[model samples]
Target: MNAEHGTPASAEPGTLRPGGRTARVRAAVLDAAGDALAEQGFAHLDLADVARRAEVGRTTVYRRWGTVTGLVADLLTDMAESSLPRSETGSLLGDLTANARLVQRTLADPRQGALFRAVIAAATCEPRTAEALHRFYDVRVREWAPCVRQAVDRGEAPAGTDAHEVIRAVSAPLYYRLLTTAEPLDPAAADRAAAATAAATRAGAYVRPSPAP
Candidate 1:
């Protein structure tokens, strides 16, 4: 299990999100990879091409990430590391609204939206890619899950509320809209998603069930 945190960094890239020459190389490679994915999808991604685009040596790219799955996995790791921290808005609704807005903004951005679609498509056929994608979401969910727990503590949500489920629900609709219809992911749509999820959570629809004997 190439866990998000413990995976040994190859000698070239010094640390996660650190600043220096190695970090610049990493940033360049990831930016190039993203551009390729957004423009041509995962099927066309190549390490040599990414190296060329990043203006780094092909040997470095090959040495750092041995395969496409490894590179894509690293890209997802970087994304999770760089994502904004969860907002603490004092209420479940406010917090969920903030979460939805962030999702909406990401999906509405042409590059990021296309990049997500490309990775999702790749994940369907690639086992390693799917694992990486799941890990990426897990990181994001954990980030926002604390807010739901805070809601329970504040009495804005019922006891035994499943924090992760509530967080997922808030973002699900926005991602669905982005992937399904050719609809514009506007602020109104984000607000609706937040409202719906917050309402369901308050109604105890997301309460955790006891284990069966």
Candidate 2:
């Protein structure tokens, strides 16, 4: 997948999100794929198994996805498309707090947390999955970046602040905790992440450095 455009090099009909009947098939297959990944991890994710779980024809799965990685890539794309939109709470802290809480809730969910772990593990060796993961986060970052721009406009964040970086900072700690420790992803942790990011953003920590003349 192209990082900038989040599209495959070949824009085939199979790659595109379909409408009507095919949309139902796509949703089923992706849900099955996610369940398999969460339960069995990437190494055991079989297309035939996913087809059976989805109650679809094996040939349909093969013809549409071709391989497990292809199916996984599409799953990540669908996840990004289905994620909740960023909150607009006027204050930068409020907006970032909303973002953090969303991340916390997602990581705290058993199925979603397991699915993310499976995908992150797969991305370690699979170049295609890695690219898909990059595109997934890229889409998310872009979605919330406008809040930082709004902060700058409102004089809450410094001028020349890197909006994308600020958005990333808000979620980075939550993800790290999810991956590293066994601590519960509580609301307090989310609030801490939001506060830290908002403070750093206002202090110009994320300001883009000017090029040396």
Candidate 3:
């Protein structure tokens, strides 16, 4: 695996002017790559074109990202890290509602929505891209897992509920609406997902099963 693919610095354009020319060049290349990916999709992402767009050399782009998958992996990591922290609203319903709203708002944004759709389409045919996409979700799920655990402590949910899975479930419908249904990712859909998932969790839908003898 390429180090740049996993390194946070490669995900976005760096602002540190002290790292000198090399850092600036790397940042420029990465930013250009991101724009290319967002605009053209992975199939049309050309390193030479990215270099031209960034006014950087092709050798620099290749030397840093190595391949399209590597670039995409770094981009996903960047996106995950840059995302807002999970809301702590002191209750499971409130927290889940916050989560759903955040997801709905993000998926409904024009630029981000298009970028996600393109990335998702790319992941369908690229195993590495799929792994990166999974990693993005894992980070998000972990971010909100504590909320579920807190709900359990507060007696809002069963003690054995899988917090991560519960958090994941809250967003599944929103993503389904975005990818499958042509329905708008609006506040109504967000509220429905949050309410449904919260109700299911309270009903023990996410509780772990008892071990079989």
> Where does candidate 2 clash, by residue pair?
none
Instruction: Compute the lDDT for candidate 3.
Output: 0.84
| All candidates in order of lDDT, best leading | 2, 1, 3
- Per-candidate clashes, comma-separated: 0, 0, 0
Candidate 2: which stretches are off by over 4 Å? 1-14
How well does candidate 2 score on lDDT at residue 149? Answer: 99
TM-scores for all candidates? 0.91, 0.94, 0.86
CA deviation > 4 Å runs, candidate 3:
1-27
Give the Å shift of residue 45 in candidate 3: 1.3
Q: After superposition, how far is residue 93 of candidate 2 from its true place, in Å?
A: 0.2
Output the lDDT of residue 110, model 3. 80
lDDT of 2: 0.91
lDDT of 2 by residue, 10-55 (tens): 6642368767777898899999999999999999999999999999
Clashing pairs in 3: none
Given candidate 2, what's the lDDT at residue 159? 92
Per-residue lDDT of 55-97 in model 1, one digit per residue for the tens?
A: 9999877766778888898899899889999999898899999
Cα deviation of 55, candidate 1, in Å: 0.1
